[model samples]
Target: MTAVIAEEDINRIRWHCRRGMLELDMVLARFLEEHADRLTAPQWQEFERLVSLEDHALWQRITATSVTDSTVERLLRGCIIC
Candidate 1:
C-alpha cells in the first residue's frame, strides 16, 4: 500500500480490524492478516475507512440491509461472495 506495508503497521491494522460484530471481525481481521501487505494504497486507505464505521452500519453493509457506499463494498467483495 503506502510504500508497501510494514509488519508493525500490519499488526496495528490487524488489531483495529477486531470489530464489534463477530462476522465483521472474522471477515476483516482475516482479510487484513492475509492481504494487508498486498493491498494498493487506495485499498489500504479504503480499508481503514471501512473499519472506522460503527458496528450497526458495518453490519448493514455486510448483510445487505443498506445499499451503502461502494468503498466498503468493493473492499469486501474480494473476501465475501454474494
Candidate 2:
C-alpha cells in the first residue's frame, strides 16, 4: 500500500514547486494540484529530486529540450504538465 503524504511535506513540496520561470511554475502547480495527494513515497522522493534541480535544468526536463535522468524523465511523463 502507498503511504499517505504528510501535510507538512505537502506544504514543503508546494513551496518548492514555485519556480523562477512562470511557465515552469504553472506546470508544476498544476501537477501538484492534480497529483500531490496521491503520490506514493517513492514518487515523492523523485519529485523532490526534480524540484531540487536548477531552474533551467528542471525546465529542460519539463519541456524535453534536453535529456534528463530516466527516473525524473519518467515522472515528468506522468505529470499533467507533460
**Clashing residue pairs for model 1:** none
lDDT of 1 at 60: 67
User: What TM-score does prediction 2 earn?
Assistant: 0.77
Where model 2 places Cα greater than 4 Å from the true spot, the runs are 65-82
Candidate 1 has an lDDT of: 0.69
lDDT of each: 0.69, 0.75
Which predicted model would earn the best TM-score?
2
User: Candidate 1 on 1-82: residue-level lDDT in tens?
Assistant: 2448777887887888787677787778656656665677777777777678898877666667446566546556456534
What's the true lDDT of residue 70 in model 1?
A: 64
lDDT of 1 at 9: 80
TM-score of every model?
0.70, 0.77
Model 2 lDDT-worst window of ten: 73-82
Stretch of 10 with least lDDT, candidate 1: 73-82
